[model samples]
Target: MPLILFNKPFQVLCQFTPQEGRESLADYLSIPGIYPAGRLDADSEGLMLLTDDGKLQHKIAHPDHKEAKTYLVQVDGAIDAAALARLQAPLDLGDFVTKPSKAVRIAEPDWLWPRNPPIRERADKPTSWVAITLEEGKNRQVRRMTAAVGFPTLRLVRSSIGPFSLATHPLMPGDFIEVPANAIHK
Candidate 1:
């Protein structure tokens, strides 16, 4: 079983196919026959898992499996306790209601790498960090949730998916590590 852990950079598409004027996984991944288990929008960055095994891919990506994915998010303004409560509550995203998730303010992770073309700095409003862990992978869910709660997400980074974490692998942007399929334990 070929399982790869990739550190996806901001603005890089999740798929391997080349996109016009945009970077794709192919730009960083040269391995053949592997596909992303879940997608991270081009604007988001961090842990991405790829595999050749169809079963493992589905297990990792399918919402029904309820595999938790953790994110480190930077919001435009300071987040208050009320905002945290709203975020923790089930959120209706119009399309679907998100399952209850854990959201709490956390110090900026010291191990995080600075994103390229760094997130725009606003002198008027101070930014704060939050850790959000969700079991479902919705389209730009973290960004949407933060905005809905009145603090727009300025930067989003997925730090872990289930038991697989960027910290364990310590991969830099565009770097990857192949591991045995059994290495990931729920």
Candidate 2:
């Protein structure tokens, strides 16, 4: 079976199992047996890969693979050079220390679609975007990392995972397409 690349929207849960008052993968996907290779929190948006193959799913999700996942993070404040440097280096998040990552300030992506419920904006505050790529994704790591650096994440979007990317395969929210399962290995 091929892999399914989906553009997950904000506030959609990352499971097939139904939950009260929350939309799950089942809502957008009726493809039987397919499971998400990795999870994006309900509050997060963008690229997700689903596969029916158990081994492939595990290979992408497991920390051992150190599959690179990149996020476009919209955060509070100007997101100066100091914060960018701090993000690139590992900062103890209390529960666990993170590995060094690639973090750089970027202009808001031209291709980005707005969130259904747009992020909060304060009259005196300006938000900045940062492209952060990490090999190991711990739970809510990007959100936690930004908050630790004094610029809390207002919007979190996964732009790519491993060799697959929204840039290479652009899809609007709730849209999906099947690609060769071996695409990621190339």
Candidate 3:
């Protein structure tokens, strides 16, 4: 099985196909017969897994499998204990209620790379960092969750999926490495 770990940069579409004047995965990767196991939106920067194995792809991407994905978020306001509690509890998202998730305030990671078009800054307001681990990957779920809690996310980065993580195998944007398929078992 060919398993690839890719660091997706901001503004790149998650698909391999060409889009109208926007960059896609095809611009960064030309490997044939492999597709993204899960998608990260064009606005979110993060780690993405791609593979040729259909079964493995389904197992990784399907919400029923409950694969844990960790994200480092920069929100617009200074996070507080009450906000963290609400994030950890089951909160209604209007369309659907989210499952209880792991959320904690964290210091901004020192190793994070600067985004090309930096997030807007306001001198009057403050921004804080949070680490959130979710079992399901709903569309724009992280952004919605933060916004619901009164801390709109300014920047988002997926730091890990299941057993693989950028903390252990750091890759720059648009860079990729084929890891052993068996590494997923650990």
Q: What is the C-alpha RMSD of each candidate to the true structure, in Å?
A: 1.0, 0.8, 0.8
C-alpha TM-score for every candidate: 0.97, 0.98, 0.98
Stretches off by above 4 angstroms in model 2 are: none
Residue 97, model 2, lDDT: 91
Residue pair clashes in candidate 3: none
Clashing pairs in 2: none
What is candidate 1's CA lDDT for residue 3?
90
Query: Which runs in model 3 stand beyond 4 Å of their true positions?
Result: none
Per-residue C-alpha lDDT of model 2 across residues 1-186, encoded as one tens digit per residue:
879999999999999999999999999999998999989999999999999998888889998875799999999999999999999998999999999999999999999998988888799999999999999998999999999999999999999999989987889999999999998777
Name model 1 segments beyond 4 Å from true.
none
| lDDT digits (tens) for residues 98-179 of candidate 1 | 8899999999988999999899997999999999999987888999999999999999999998888887779889999998
